[model samples]
Target: MYHVHLPKLEQMGLIEPSGNWYDIRRGPRFDEIEPLLRVIDDHRKKLPGDVL
Candidate 1:
């Protein structure tokens, strides 16, 4: 995930990696997906077990 997922998300402006490479923070575009994440969390129990 360090080489694949993290870089992909970073490229999309969804996550920002720390200078030391040991931490991460929300990127500028995080707001774009925040609503979707909230909806998913709100209905997580109703979703299929494997969906998450």
Candidate 2:
């Protein structure tokens, strides 16, 4: 899963890996989608796993 998403994220300046860890600190691209991500996260938490 990491390999699948890494290239696109790197292209968008959203992650920088060092050693074995991925750095997910704030970046311009991430900022642009943070609000939407937060909304989705909140919604996800409210839903039951069976419904999901």
Candidate 3:
């Protein structure tokens, strides 16, 4: 399921791929404590500056 959305998200500007790395676009909405904070949010966060 998740593997299927990767390309779509990339094309939508939500994610950018570079070799084995990916960068996510950040914005005010990205920090919302609700949509992303909810356990039911459906996905986990992958910050650009996070240590892999």
Candidate 4:
């Protein structure tokens, strides 16, 4: 589920924990998740640079 995936991302510091919100963590770029991110990028055409 989406909820389960988020905590895993947080644990990896790919995303940070805000006040009950998930703010993306610093550095470590989405290229780290190229296979997955690429699939997503293909669907969306673009991903917000602010997050990746």
How close is each model in CA RMSD to the real structure? Answer: 1.9, 3.6, 9.7, 7.5
Q: TM-score: which candidate is best?
A: 1
- The TM-score of predicted model 2 comes to 0.58
lDDT of 3 by residue, 1-52 (tens): 2466766656555555556345545333334445545654444355344433
- Which window of ten consecutive residues has the lowest lDDT sum in model 4? 22-31
Q: Whose TM-score is higher: candidate 1's or candidate 3's?
A: 1
Model 1 lDDT per residue over 1-52, tens place? 2477888889999999988456899999999999999999999999987898
Regions more than 4 Å wrong, model 2: 20-24, 45-52
Give lDDT per model, in order.
0.90, 0.67, 0.50, 0.63
The residue-by-residue lDDT of candidate 2 on 1-52, one tens digit each, is 3477776776787765555445455445777788887787779868778544
Q: For each of the candidates, give the backbone clash count.
A: 0, 0, 0, 0
Evaluated at residue 14, the lDDT of candidate 1 is 96
How do all the candidates rank in terms of TM-score, highest first?
1, 2, 4, 3
Query: Model 4, which residues run further than 4 Å from truth?
Result: 22-31, 34-52
> Candidate 4, clashing residue pairs?
none
17: Cα error in model 1, Å: 0.2
lDDT for residue 25 in candidate 3, whole number 0-100: 52
